[model samples]
Target: MNHNLFGIIVVFAAAAAWGMSGIFVTLIIDSSGCSSVALAFWRDFTTFCVLLLYTLVTAPHRLTIQKKDILWFLAMGCCLGGFHIFYNKSVMMNGAAVTTVQQAAMPAVVTIAAWYLWKEALTREKIVAMVIIFSGTVMASGLNLFTLERINVTGLMVGFIVPFFYAGWTLCGKNIVNRYGAVPCLAIAFGIAATMLLPLQPFVTQPGFLNCKIILIFSGLIGLSTVGAFTFYMIGLKYVQAGIASILVMSEILFAGVYAWFLLNERLSFVQTIGAIFVIIGVAWLSFKKPDAASE
Candidate 1:
């Protein structure tokens, strides 16, 4: 298979997996009444354990990490963990609309970061696709990007913070994946993410833990889905630029809508349908164009 095509397939698969997270997370929250931090802790911890076991059995050599990479691992892990913490809080405080709108800015941030850190070019096609994708994400989520409500100080801060860390995580993972490959690097990142969330349980209200069967099952799915999503994303990062990868991942919004319709009986609005179409167009434009086609 062509390398870029493979990366496109892999990243789209990751988006699909991540798209299911909302359903699983909703189930856990409904059944367990757990805080988002607690849910994230369980999800990352389970992911770490499963990946660790797999590494030990299939590729123990991948488990080894260089000394210089330790800090990167920690930073990547914290960025991811912080995204969950802040984004969840933003949703709880400001409503999902606000947070989702905030997240739409991620591609732009990532584009600049990738250019600075990795010298990835900010091509015309990429910039246009990013704008379309972000616009579609807002429309698909039934949000008015320009008419967003005023959030309180806490919500506002965390709302912005969520995408900052998410952008950091994406670019950081791009570098880490190039150096250590996907699975082992993910193992280390998730291990650190799980560790970071573990101690925060006290600060947050966590009732579920292992007490609820539905929460347990959903939490397990979150872990496995996370592993699948991040692994595929990192694999794709090896081929795609961080900026393009971020735009591709925006497909998660559309996928989440699909999953919601399938599992939660939620129906998409007409505008949302149009928004989904726009997202498809944006992603396809990026995926099918020649490698140098978007280059300046």
Candidate 2:
């Protein structure tokens, strides 16, 4: 029981750290002016080094990647990698407030995916929650939710990918964890994803890629947000109930809104506030339900 409590604490901390990543990345980009490719490469590279160092020092003997799971890991890594690149890119294009809204929309996607593809049963309460969330967010976005305004179609598409691919990652993560154990699997996946970006740094990068200061900032991302925070989350999840873990992560949206509004000087429109509220409520409902028809 104590172990479980620790895990939940880790997960909550990871959620908050993740929420801050956007604001951090935004500051980095404002200083660096690098393309998404370069920015992504450095980001993943820093994380790779952190994961690699930990694995080498602590579990050098245990770091073998199964030949079978190698391919699976690679594929998952690509999807996961793409998700990060696109999510960060979205923040670069859209402001943090909107990015937060878009991410807040993820539970809807995960629930929908689980229901339709996994055949998970959805309760009436869950459906109502989704509806309320959608209505509220639409109200928050103000200028017709579907219309192109400050957030263009390209940015919109990229922003949406954050949840879409994360939902996909969540699905893939279950299989990988079942097969290879989470730590090594996550490590391998990060390895493959990092390798996927090594070739493009020169072709797409500018002065920022070489900036020592930017490099340090990027490493801060890996250290605090990715490695340390995620480690806490993974540990916490092992002890706490998954439903509780999901609920605890609701803090990300809250954190993001506070950080953006207070630190980043971003303003949230009434519509966006409504949308954010809906997203929180919807996710709370969806994450709490038991999977019946979803995963037989």
Candidate 3:
């Protein structure tokens, strides 16, 4: 098989696994009455443990980090921690489909931030793509300025805010990822996030919180959604161009929408569906266009 084709397949599979995250989150919340914070904590903690063990076995030297890089990892971890809390909260309030569509704005956010912070080119194509992405996110959120019908204002706000933290996570890890490798950096970041959320650990001790159903959900969430998704994505990046990988990762939005519609009975409105299409088109446009030489 062609290496690029193989990478595309792996990345798509990773997206599919990530798409199931919301379903598992909803199921755990419904069955165990776990708070969003608790769920985030457990997810991070379990993923960290798994990644840590993998690092220990495969590349123990990667675990060592310079003291100077601690701050970078801390920032990355905090961004990831913030992302989890708000993302899960948004999912709880808005359901999976809407939240996932809102998350599609991440690439736009990252693009804008890069231009601002790193002097990356702010090209016409990227500007147009950002506009389309923002417009689509607003529509997908079901926020009608005229009537304000079918809108959860808080959820919409929270959902929209998710991309900022996600972008921050990406930006913060960009430099350090080269130094420490993706898995080790991610393992450390997850550990830091889990540590930050440790105060919520008591919630896990509540009656029925650790029941069989919730346990199973956690296992799937940690094993498939978190660990498996990241592992596949990192490997896929080794074989594919970053732009193509970004485009392929958009599959998560579609997969999440389908899973929500079938399993959770969450349906997107006509406008929302159109908005999702717009987001996909916009992000793909951005992915396909290369920045000018000045930016590179």
Cα lDDT computed for each candidate against the true fold: 0.79, 0.65, 0.75
> Residue-wise lDDT of candidate 3 within 167-259, one digit each (tens)?
777666654776777788889999999999898777553325448877888888989998898767766655554434544576676677777
Q: Residue 122 in candidate 1 has what lDDT? A: 80
Q: Of models 1 and 3, which has the larger TM-score?
A: 1
Q: Is candidate 1 or candidate 2 better by lDDT?
A: 1
Clashes of 3: 0
Mind giving the per-residue lDDT tens digits that candidate 1 earns over 1-296? 88778788888899888777655665666676778797677777778887788878887887788888778888999988888777666766676545766887888999988888767888888889988887788788886555645647677777988889889888888887877778888888889999998888888767455667775656556554688888899999998778888888888887788878887799989998998899899989988877763332
Worst 10 residues of 3 by lDDT: 238-247
| Span of ten consecutive residues with least summed lDDT in model 1 | 287-296
lDDT of 2 by residue, 17-95 (tens): 8877876787788888877767677666667777777777777765676676666677767866777788778888876
Model 2 worst lDDT window (10 residues): 287-296
Which candidate, 2 or 3, has the higher lDDT? Answer: 3
Candidate 2's clash total is: 13
Error of model 2, residue 231, in angstroms: 3.4
